[model samples]
Target: MRSGKSKRVSGTGSGSRKGSGRGRRPGKTAGTSHHAAYNAGVAEGTSLNQSGGGRLSGHEAKLQMNERWTRRCMAKGASAGTAGKRIQESRAFAAGFAAALGQPDSAWQPVQLTRSAAAVVFAGPDANPASIRQLLRLPLEEIIVVQEGASEAQFAELKALPEIKILNPGEPLGADVWRAVGARVTRADIVLFADAAQLIEAEKLAQLLGAVQAGADVALVSYASRLGPFREWDDLMRVRAFVNWTLGRKELGVSSIGLLPHVWARSAMDAVGVKMLAVPPLAHVTAIQQRLRVQACPIAKRTANESGKSYQGLPPQASRKLTNESLQTVFGDHIEALRAAMKLKGARLAMPDNSRCRSAAGGAE
Candidate 1:
């Protein structure tokens, strides 16, 4: 009886030890282990970029490391899920660091367009079916269509296109919201952004891609516009240009780079915090503030009047609010101060004449 009891006790003890060891292995490896490495990478990258003023270069370095980390993990027989989680943690770190620095993720390395390339087409409810078809036909590895407000027919048409992936946010989240969504969903070297109404051609996409390949952090489509019937639209550009001038970027003016048919490095957008809104003006402001290399590729000649279908392609109130917001963001708090100062100066300069002094001097009193 004593011998049988001892055997049972020993067996139970051994099983408990084995189970405890198994649980500790995963806890140490998956939680504490990877976390330490990820934090180290973030701290090192953030410090290096901040010190050297090499934000863009630092971004490229982090991206390369992420790719390598994923590859090594996969080669070592790690599951795809494990590899992806590690990569995502590193990416999230980089993104947060970039935002804290008030800059876009600028890449010093030439973009590798072949392996990681995609497009995000932000289509409105009135998107033409033919245009959607044209966009899908582009020679892109992956295409994501974010439909803001679509009819059942529109959803059906988009769904039928096997080459494209569709995202319906159920309601209109604004252009910037959709743009950011597109950026997040795509893991491409260069992410092409376009509006459904923009009538972007395959060749145009190639041109934008070419600009990105040549080291432009973001490439925009530029066209000339004159002040006339579309006074409001012209005023928007004027405000943008004025803000740029105030920033001492006198040679730069607001352009269509944010309008659509634009391409940006994925790393750059990711670092910029992929926000709920990223208008063309805001995009320009961010790239400029980050000191990113921005290139403008001129489009085929066309009247500015022929460019937009609706007035500025936005509802009147939305147009006003977004325009104001973009201008305020670009100019900063100093703009309000400047306006107040001007008002004070004007009041002083236009002070009412001293009527009593005039009467006394003329001996009228």
Candidate 2:
């Protein structure tokens, strides 16, 4: 069922025409005083333009430009929303089909392995490794921490954990981290690309593994933001996420955003290529997620605060830009590619209910 939100109107319409001289012939008898006054007003400064026949004034032109921009933004937003809805519907159909096929929910069994899953933690210079160590109590087979501008001492401190590997990039952190996570790690069934400050739940690792066993390629974990009460940043993030999830599912035939603390299969990670992350993390992840049938698994609440500190030494503006780029990469032309691939493969694409996915799959308690 479609959500009750009103369908947004596309912003496309003709601009207002300037006053016409043909309407007022030179020899025409001006009938009424009101008409004369109107003409006078047009001749005076009230009207946009008088000398150029039907040209608009600078202010009028500016107004038109603003209107056009406004319309474009609205149209873009509407288009995104429509795409998202389509994905949701497709998922629903797929889920119903699966149910009808009598596909047992617990048919797939989890891999019985004694080794712990490897988690790749991408941390900033200022992240408190202590907090991360305390939060994530998973029996990690290997913990690879990628830090930028961190001292050897700090790296050593983080590597105090058993079976931990610390890599400090003297220069800017690049695809090396992604490559390590994608290629280097051998025993890793699940890879958790996370920040140091992000507090992952104790059971998050197990839950992620469960989802993977259930046939999910990528699984995203949900957490609450513990930053300020509510801000524009939060709203924008929500909108971005909603749009990403909707469009990714519908147009790209993949699941995109929901929450952080993401977990994914090692095989799928290798397939998408590590270089993809360096280009656009979100988009790359989305492409891989769709390609691999990414799923979501609810976990602990995520708290983001000023104390959490920044990563990659990137300014706030740069971070935002990176995120936007990632979104564009995932949903841009990639969606069309995914659709084409789906058609070629004769894959049955379904749109599941976003509400149900959000609730049951992952996000919040």
Candidate 3:
């Protein structure tokens, strides 16, 4: 019973397994700062080392290699942990990956320009200083924090930073509308939008930015894990799935621009118009119809700490009363999106439109 071998578990899309029951909110489980810096450095070093051997950009190429390696190890029955350890060892062959890991963040300062990006975060009721600190660490040229009835001391840290720009509108801008506001303010090639109140991580945000850099027009944090089994999903989940499915993107599952921290390419925003960003569902649908590259990027090391929290798993207990207004707003937006899609692709959405002889009933043709 003592074989000196490891068992690997390949995860092309981690936390998406049908009955796995690990529906954690995405973004919180990002590796710590030191780990993040090291991984980023390794990714960058690998990209540099490749020197354009294949069609894939360094990021995509490295991602593919990792998936392949994981799959190979799993085929031979290696544990996920073992595969991970081995992968860390194998990355040495990626040329400078080993050296990059050893180097400090200061050592790689010269090449940080490539990560230039921007963010629009709404500090809702859940705002906190820690989350704001995380946002500042990204390579964003500016972080536009929209304060929703927050006090002066509420976002002191945001104002303290030279890169932070606080926007205080006399009247409230609806939930996702701030995305449009931020998009209008920034000239960055890549932009991120999120509710600053969320307990998200800087490294995860950076990953979304990196995806745009690697050529995805819209990079969504995979939220499939948050939506338990398909059979037990609620109307919200159904709507999300239907939206992606109706647009010939069933593979995206329940990922939507309406939820989670998502990033977009400036070109994609330009194509759809910044105003479209106000209605996230509509913007997402329009982008897909226009053939823009959208991806539901799988989050690595996702944390399930929010297990008892509402909406990420089993139905909220009786104590957690559903907010009717929020529900109506989201559903209304979904209707508007579907209506817009119907206008472009007929009411049936990608399904065949039968050519009927209406003239048979009337006296035309």
Candidate 4:
């Protein structure tokens, strides 16, 4: 029999978030609460990420921990195991996965990608297909692998699989270009873009997929760590912030479709037009103009994969270097977005009109 105090502690395992204490020795409080919660019949959500000494070993370690938690949750109560939610991607992406980990045996089941869903993965020359083993578990309708500068023999394992299509552009193409190509060909209502070299954990990926399945037009993996005081931000963050501000999406901060591990709805791609996807900032601006639902998932920065070494042919590099050399490259992309917006809605674009049309009163004309 669990006492009421101990039952309250179980909130950590059940995703209640009510028992966290910040009083003297916050670490002690959290540790005691986590242990007490586990003894009360459910594992804490933090267990998925916390390991020996609060360190992350890798994705494989987390998967093994999650599997154990699944079995234990089922043994406790089959009814509670089916608990799930369909909120916006932010909560749905974090709490949905964490809470479901305590209830269901099949954590991936709640986040199923429909037959109308597809995945576009761009593999570099040094990318290993084996890293995506868990992603193969999702019941996505189709998966298009766009490999760059890699031989057919490199992906032999996934080559013979049904529903898997590989495209070789004969030369190395950037990730955004691959995303544009995938958008042009895939005919699903929901689409996922991925890099073959990224070793994202299955749960983290599922939460992002879950968000899109819950009706988001775009599901971006939130790199919240990138945000802080404005004074400390780098040029990339500054450029993203500036573009987002001009687009009347100041609330978006640095989040953008240009970042990888994002999901999109086919309608969004069509609204922006397939060609615009090659320029993600413009595509994002177009989506906003089209009134699409763009959301950021709330997976913590700790969930980020920190172990992988950068591969030579990976194309995210092109995006990283686009403007770090000088602000000119980034300004070019933003200029195009502003130009596209003005073409549709006049010089004001979508920004609010606070002042009267001073341009109309100009006597110089």
By TM-score, who's the top model here?
3
* Per-residue accuracy of model 3 over 252-302 as CA lDDT, tens digit each: 888888775888988899998899999888998999999999988765443
lDDT of 4: 0.54
Clashes of 1: 3
- Model 1 over residues 1-365: C-alpha lDDT tens digits? 01111110010011111110011111233455445444544454455445542423332343333444444444565432212234334333333333323322311111223335567887676676655554443335467799877778878876776456788888767446778777777666777887676554343454566567657777765543333344555554666556555444545555534456678876677555567135545555555556677766553332111112212222112222346666555445334423443344442222335656545576322
Q: Candidate 3 — which residues are off by over 4 angstroms? A: 1-115, 302-322, 353-365
State the weakest 10-residue window (summed lDDT) of model 2. Answer: 103-112
Each prediction's TM-score versus the true structure: 0.50, 0.44, 0.63, 0.60
Native-referenced Cα lDDT, model 1: 0.48
Q: Of the pair 1 and 2, which is ahead by TM-score?
A: 1
lDDT of 2 by residue, 1-365 (tens): 12232222111111124433223221234334324422432333223233331243222332222233224324444221111222222222222221222221201111112223556666666667754563233333446676776666777777664435666656775532443433353346656565665544333444555455456667654322322333534433444344444434423211232233556666676676554444333434345445676554433333211133322211111122236655555345444544554554333333344555455645432
- Name the runs in model 4 displaced over 4 angstroms: 1-115, 151-163, 172-175, 300-331, 348-357, 360-365
| Positional deviation of residue 323's Cα in model 3 after best superposition, in angstroms | 2.4
Candidate 3 local accuracy as lDDT? 0.57
